[model samples]
Target: MARVELYVSADVEADGPIPGPYSMLSFGLAVCGTFDGTRFTAPDPSERTFYAELKPISGDFDPQALEVSGLDRERLLREGRDPAEAMRAAAAWVKTVADGALPVLVAYPLAYDWMWLYWYWVRFTSRSPFGHSRHLDIKTFYAARAGAMAARSTKRQMPAALLSARPHTHNALDDAVEQAELFQNLFRWGG
Candidate 1:
């Protein structure tokens, strides 16, 4: 078993068409054990997933994504914390609760979380945790490993044998799971 300290997974609900140039709505995190020769199958049980929502600085949000999230604006305003506060709380929890890499699984281009976190941290404290510039793009790695399996589009492809049902995009945790599935597929195909 490869001794991995920890593994963390994060999902961000963005306020814009995507995750930049606007604001964030909510963020959730799931923490697990590192590789352990099982490719991070079993997460540490003590610290489960934590979900947090934030109030937008301006209420002008992307209506389409909003519909997808199904978040109630009024409820967010009532319950949401400021972005800085939320990020700080998130950082605190991650630092204390997680024990893996500096950053967690984003299932996206690093820029997505980088920008959101940069905006919040700099706006409040003038710093971003991602300054070091180390990140792993799962699809990129998978495509490289699965050169012949390339589907010609800039999206991740799961071999039919690996999928449980159908592919549903945009749901954060679901996407993360799908990405993991793709990685596993690549590993299996390689062997």
Candidate 2:
């Protein structure tokens, strides 16, 4: 029997460009759908999801980055969830969503979100739910499918049908769900 693949869309909000120097303020994951050898199945993207806000690991943060995230560092320092605990819960949630299927992380561009998630997972728990390389980039997927230049394949350039109706709110969870919709559309597209 062919192994089933679960696509989990992810988004991250961070205080700085890199992980260790700043911090990942929050992140979210939404199970977009699944694919077996012969077919793709899209369930409600909001049905199985995970989100967390974490305390900063360092005292340092870029003002601009923090402003973009809109996460109060002082508040997080006082009330955010412990990073280790949050990461563990996220891992378990991913496994539960997978339910024996192989879980594959999905993101718009994949690089930034994957970097933060993989780093945090390994740092906090010493393991990652999606493993090191089981992932997909929706942007690249769309580029390849549409036969468009990767750099030129931003959402604005895509056909309206392929875009999600939800606005990019920059709240990790909301963006993740929106991204899940984009993934489902991209995955099922024939062109």
Candidate 3:
């Protein structure tokens, strides 16, 4: 099989989890280590891009999360694109970059990236844009490697010290970079 380059979808949420019936505040995304991109755009029709962002549906922002993402709510309201635009852009970007089969690796699989994205799409666009139903859950992958595997939830993650990992920006792009680094580290550690 051809080597499958990496792609990630990320989100920097406020306080609410999936079924957010709560809120998602802001989001940013980037694809790295393959296309040599400074932004999320895919350079070729066959290449792929990873995406992320924060979406505040209900207006409830988590103080800590807000502090972490550093996205200005007012700025988002004034400048941010609508959910439809974002999704369409994301799908178009992916069409340009993705070369894999299906079911890509996302940090938290169902909840964080996939579930939240699906929710946003179904709620706002009335359709789902994802090509697959599965995602590689990093937390569980790390845990299984560490013999402590559990279900995936944003609230959970492999202990940072386990991989001597440093802090993550929690910003969408930064977090995606960190997750890729963590996955690579796990691979090197024989996980």
Candidate 4:
């Protein structure tokens, strides 16, 4: 049997730099593409996705970070889904979309997003759908694949052909879709 890798483009909006001390206000995931050891299939960004806004686990949050997401912190506190429930739902969604393939989380500059997601998964669900280390950083992937300096691998430094048409609206789902487009572009770049 061949291995199947389901590339999931994920994004997160957080209230602070780290989890536990803050919270993941929201998160989104889009199944960008899949490779079944021989061939690749790139899906439209609007297809097969998940999004959630979670209640805070802590009282601390950075005002500026919260502002960036443009989400009402007070409203989230009042109405957001419980973290455990949200994480469980998210995990189930991932499993359903993945359809037995290994789902690998992909994100531009993945560290921050990965931190919030992995922490939430462990803290709430006891394990992650992507496990502890199955993540791909688009920035690092581009740096190595395009021969650019890792420190200078921002989207501005990328080729226009590889950029997504979608705007970066700071909404977790929008960004996830945008990054999904970017990931598809990169995945089909040389083949």
* Winning candidate number (lDDT): 2
On lDDT, the stronger of 1 and 4 is: 4
Per-residue accuracy of model 2 over 140-173 as CA lDDT, tens digit each: 9999999999988999999999989999988999
User: In each prediction, how many residue pairs overlap at the backbone (N, C-alpha, C within less than 3 A)?
Assistant: 1, 0, 12, 0
Candidate 3 lDDT: 0.53
lDDT of each: 0.56, 0.93, 0.53, 0.92
RMSD of 2: 0.8
How good is model 3 by TM-score? 0.66
Clash pairs, candidate 1, are 32-43
Q: Which residue segments of model 2 deviate by more than 4 Å?
A: none
The lDDT ranking, best first, is: 2, 4, 1, 3
Between prediction 1 and prediction 4, the one with superior TM-score is 4
Of 1 and 2, the candidate ranking higher by TM-score: 2
Task: Give me the overall lDDT of model 2.
Answer: 0.93
Give lDDT: candidate 4, residue 101.
Answer: 94
lDDT agreement of model 1 with the native: 0.56
